[model samples]
Target: MEILQVIILGLCLGFVYALMVSGLTLIFGVMRIVNLAHPILIISGAFVSYWLFILFGLDPILSVPAAALTVALLGVLLYKLIFEKNAAQQTYSEMTVLLTFGTAMVIDGLLAFLFHNTQRTASPAYATDAIFIGDIFIPLAQLYSGMVSLGIIVVLALFLKYSEFGIAIRATSQNRTSAELVGVNVKFVCLISFAIGCALAGSAGSLVSFVFSFFPSRHWEWIAILMSLVVLGGMGSLTGAVIGALVLSVVSSLVGAFYSPAWSTMVFFLALFLILIIRPRGLFGIRTD
Candidate 1:
């Protein structure tokens, strides 16, 4: 029963993990540029939800769209100022990594300065409520967050499959030169892809704000853990990221429940190492090169 509870909890958390990694992987697939600053954008989203609640008394869930849209606009600005101006010959160049990593640091520092380094959670009364099943209990916040995560994933999937912009994004990711030659604005697609990716991150953050306690610096921990999921699933595969999240979240939860809390975090990186050794490209990862 305890193990079952743990698995249930893990899957619940996995829903949000899947949502978070989806954007990261999508951005990598389309641009061939890993957004190392992605985690901070999620944190920025969380702060947006946090402040909206603290200042205006809005529910965190209700704040998600506003946070997502805000980050989407910021994503536009970020691409224009950073990536657009410095289009390198090599997409995955060392300079791209440094630029994004530095940008992550800047966002982190600025957020810390403005919001302080203290831990916070958007804990409304409903967040504490739980539904009981026999001997197991599920928190309302996790359940709601999971539902919202699923909704967002479905919306994205539909967009990618049916929408014009979505088709363009897929074409560009599959082959940039061919896409450009065939009337797709490759640069514009890149910009839109980055924006959508960041918007997803921010929406995930809104869910995360209610489900977990976090500080501005938590991105360090999040990025490391998420990297494992991203790698385990493959860099650009949406399905892979979701599966990796479920597997890793379950593993981490089981390790924490059966072994110790401290070791739970190690499981993430360890999974990354083991997966890389077994399959250098990841379970479903295709080489972009």
Candidate 2:
């Protein structure tokens, strides 16, 4: 029974985790740039939701779209002002790593200045409520957030599979030069893809607003978790990211149930290590060889 409860909780949490890393994966898939600032953007989205609730009594769920749009615009600005410059350079990959890391620090400082270092969470009416299924209890916040995350992922997947722009993005991901030669407008695709990624992160953050306490610096912890999920699932693979997140989340939950939360935190690294040893390209990553 305890194990069942833990698994249920973990699965719900995993959905949210999947949403959290989805945008980063998309960004990597489309642009091949590791947006280290992704974690900070998520926290920024959380703050947006938090303030919306505090200032206007808006529900976190209702705040999601606004948060997503706001962060997406920020993503556009980042791409236009910073990422676009050296995007064609030979050192683009290595440069983006440093650039994004710096961007993360700047955002962290800005958030700290605006919101300070204090932790905050949106407290909706259902924040602490839970549904009981026999001996198992499911937190309402987690369940709702998980459902929303899943819904978004489905919509995103469909869009990627069918939409014209989506096809362009996928083409760019597969081969930038070929996409350009086909008149896919690679620049526009990159910009829009980055924005979409940020929007997803923002949406995830809004869901996270009620489920977890957050501060600007909390992104440091989150980035590590997200990177592990991305690597475990195969960087840039949306399906892989979700699967990895679910696997890691469930394993972590089990570890916590058997031992302590602190120990559970180590599960990401351990799982990542084992996965990399077995599959160097990640579970979904394509092998060039």
Candidate 3:
């Protein structure tokens, strides 16, 4: 029963992790830029939720849409002021790394100055609530987060499948020059994609805050995990991200249950390393070029 409970908990947590990785994967799919600042943007969203909760007693879930919209606008501004300008002058990949790294540092400094280095948590009344099914206990917060993550993934998949702008974004991602030639506004598509990516990050961050305690400088740890998940899933594959998160979570949970908690973290990276060795492009990754 304990093992079963652990597996269920891990899957719920993994779904949240997938939501974070999906944002990174989406940006990579369209722009081929890793956007190292992705974690910083997530932290920014967390802070936004924190402030909103602190100021008005609003639920983190309730504040998520506003935070996501704000982050989306910030993403557009970033694309306009930095990425778009740099893309014109040099290789997009290199510039993306440099610019995003710098942005990450800037965000970290600002957050540290404002929020301090201590851990912060969004503790709602139901944070510690749980449910029992047969002999297993499940956390209510984790279940809620999982459901929200699933809903977001469904909406995103639908958008990409049926929306006109989403189709344009996909076309631009597949072939930017050809897309532009065919009357798609490549620049606009890139900006919109970036915004959508950041918005997803914001929503995920808001949801995650309900489950995890966060410090101002904690973004790097999450960044490393997210990057590994994205790479293991395939640089730009959404479904791959979801699968990678599940695989890593299940592996980590089983290891922690059978071995030591300390080994759980290492297990994820070990799995990632082994997967890369066996399948260089990842489990579901399709070679674009």
All-Cα superposition RMSD per candidate? 1.2, 1.1, 1.3
lDDT scores in order: 0.89, 0.93, 0.85
lDDT of 2 by residue, 1-289 (tens): 9999999899999999999999999999988899899999999999999999999999999999999999999999999999998898988978889999999999999999988989899999999999999999999999999899989989999999999988989889989999999888999899999999999989999999999999999999998999999999998899999999999999999999988988998999898888889987799985532
**Pairs of colliding residues, candidate 1:** none
Off by over 4 Å in 1: none
After TM-score superposition, the amount by which residue 160's alpha carbon in candidate 1 deviates from its true location, in angstroms, is 1.3
lDDT of 2 at 241: 95
**What's the TM-score of every candidate structure?**
0.97, 0.98, 0.96
Instruction: Evaluate candidate 3 by giving its C-alpha RMSD to the native, one decimal.
Output: 1.3
- On a 0 to 1 TM-score scale, where does candidate 2 land against the true structure? 0.98
| lDDT tens readout by residue for model 1, 1-289 | 9998889888889999999988998898888777888889999999999889889989989999999998889888988988887765664446667888899999999999998999999987799999989998888899899889988988998999899999999888898899999999999899989999999999998999989898889998898988889999998888889899989998999999999989988998999999989997898987876
lDDT of 3 by residue, 198-269 (tens): 999888888888788887678888877887798788878888998999878877888888899899888767
TM-score, structure 3 vs. true:
0.96
Q: Is candidate 2 or candidate 3 better by lDDT?
A: 2
Winner by TM-score between candidate 3 and candidate 2? 2
| Residue clash pairs of candidate 3 | none
Q: Which residue segments of model 2 deviate by more than 4 Å?
A: none
Residue 110 C-alpha lDDT in model 1:
97
lDDT score, candidate 2, position 218: 96
